[model samples]
Target: MCSGIRTNLHFPTCWDGKNLDSPDHQSHIAYPTAGPATFDTDGGACPSTHPVKIPQLMFEVVWDTTQFNDKNLWPEDGSQPFVFSMGDTTGYGQHGDYVFGWQGTALQTAMDNACFGATCKGLTTQTTATANKCSVPKTVNENEDGWITKLPGTEA
Candidate 1:
């Protein structure tokens, strides 16, 4: 044998703005009467509904070959040293420096590796020329395939 009880649930009727005299007139409003109340009783502007303007960042790169070479001149250390400089300016300031050390087969190999995917290569040579008289050449290939070009004549 089994026993069951029946219960009744009632949902109040909704009221539109025109039906102010209706029993469920409060339901005409969009919000529920028992739900959390909004700070804007009269429906003030929503804090998150306003449009916000974002700032745009501007940047430019200025290169002074003279300044770059002057700062990156590596002093003689018995072996020839190769020098290279790169700059990237995007909202950030200019950045330049030298990557140099040693010479011969090792130096060549290092330069080859450094300029693997680069558009230009650092100077490579066997002679340990003085900083003032040194001719730093740029390479088009990492494997020393094409002719290596010297930087435009500039005061060391």
Candidate 2:
């Protein structure tokens, strides 16, 4: 149960108020401050004129990997599975960043239920009462598909 699988989420901080995205797709906006500290309740602003400030989002979820390493669960790519990914090159940074967003009210409730969801049985035992509150994310990592990208000749 000590196996470590961590998800580090980084979001954007500043917007120029005009561009839907930047030239590099990353630079048009900026981080008011470096890293996750931008999310701090006590943190400052991104120069009043920027118009839209998407207070950075920072969070990490670490799941135990006792099962991820199991030999019986090899992934479909015929490659070592990926537990998480950032700025996947194939997508060219499309999946890498976020700017201004908040975890909506339903998100917390949904996460709680997903993490601690009880086994659903016949109608005798189901999550009907709280179904609305507990969202089933469009994508869930039901499989141990952990991918680690490294330059050639580099050990993962």
Best by TM-score: 2
Clashing pairs in 2: 12-98, 54-100, 81-145, 81-146, 81-147, 82-145, 82-146, 82-147, 83-146
Q: How close to the true structure is residue 91 of candidate 1, measured as C-alpha lDDT?
A: 21
lDDT of 1: 0.32
Residue 131, model 2: Cα distance from true site in angstroms:
10
Winner by lDDT? 2
Could you give candidate 1's per-residue lDDT for residues 30-55 as a string of tens digits? Answer: 32233222233312321232222111
Instruction: Give the runs in model 1 whose Cα sits over 4 Å from its true position.
Output: 1-51, 66-72, 75-156
Give per-model CA RMSD: 33.7, 11.6
Clash number for each model: 0, 9
Mark the regions of model 2 whose C-alpha exceeds 4 Å error after superposition. Answer: 1-3, 38-43, 47-51, 55-63, 68-156
In candidate 1, position 86 carries an lDDT of 25
- Candidate 1, residue 68: lDDT: 23
lDDT of 2 by residue, 32-93 (tens): 54333333341446655454665345554556666667655655655545433452433233
| TM-scores vs. true structure, each candidate | 0.13, 0.38
